[model samples]
Target: MNTDARSHVHALIDRLPPVQLAALETILQSMLDPLSRKLALAPIDDEPFTEEDRQAVAEADEWLKDNQPVPLENVLADFGLGMTDWETMAKTPLPEETGKRNG
Candidate 1:
């Protein structure tokens, strides 16, 4: 299967004219985003982070490394959740708890 796919790609490249071939090569070399608006086979976006964001990320990473747990079913139920709940939580607006908590 791999050999067949590779041969197919080679055949497509062989059929292209010199200018088109060079354009294809340029696309291959560029770190294009796949999720971008373009129809090309590269990524869409690669967001760079600020130093504060990076520091917060490092702190979160260390926290997770020290204290992650396999949550029990009862705990999930207490949070009014199922498997999809976590994914839903990700889509919601950021909570005010990140800053100073209100009484």
Candidate 2:
């Protein structure tokens, strides 16, 4: 941002009461949430998949086509978690848990 715009934001923040500041934080997070979710779901890179990766994905797709897909709730239950636990993790995943790829 330009210096003047940043200065204006700083001034506004300085004048906000704690409660108002908290509200502003919530508003800001709401604004950012959609973009953050999109980024999280986006592919990491534009590179073509390796042959092994392609084969693995193809196998997974074929398996899913033939077998009944497991519900997310069932999968979570296998790990002793439920919908609430998954939702909580989704909202605020740990840094180490973010952007991980499984083989």
Candidate 3:
């Protein structure tokens, strides 16, 4: 690592506005986190949108308009699960989250 370059980055970060920090955070995450890097580099889906896709969206909207909203917990309870179950299946923290950004 270049100590001078790192000092320059720290200086630039210290000078950045709060609103601009989110963009910087995203850039840094994409650089250090493998998942973020992969996603950032992933090819865009360019398939043409069809009438069937529109119809399906319309049907979903109509269903939402006609039905009462169900809470996530109620739906999960039907399958003998809860939010804690989701937590157990959650992905491990990103390198940045674990302070392992050098990767």
lDDT of 2 by residue, 66-91 (tens): 79989999999999999999888767
- Clashing residue pairs found in predicted model 1: 33-42, 33-43, 33-44, 34-42, 34-43, 34-44, 35-43, 35-44, 36-44
Per-residue lDDT tens digits of candidate 1, residues 15-98? Answer: 999999998887765545332213454365687788999999899888889897557666788988876786566544456625
Best by TM-score: 3
- Which candidate has the top score in lDDT? 2
Worst 10 residues of 2 by lDDT: 34-43
lDDT of 3 by residue, 28-61 (tens): 9999876777688778989989999999999989
Best to worst by lDDT, what's the order? 2, 3, 1
- Relative to the unseen true structure, what is the C-alpha lDDT of residue 76 in candidate 3, on a scale of 0 to 100? 85
Candidate 1 residue 44 C-alpha distance from true site, Å:
4.4
Error of 2 at 12 (Å): 22
Candidate 2 Cα misplacement greater than 4 A, ranges: 1-43, 46-48, 93-103
Which portions of model 1 show Cα errors greater than 4 Å?
Answer: 1-47, 69-78, 84-103
* Per-model TM-score on C-alpha atoms: 0.30, 0.50, 0.53
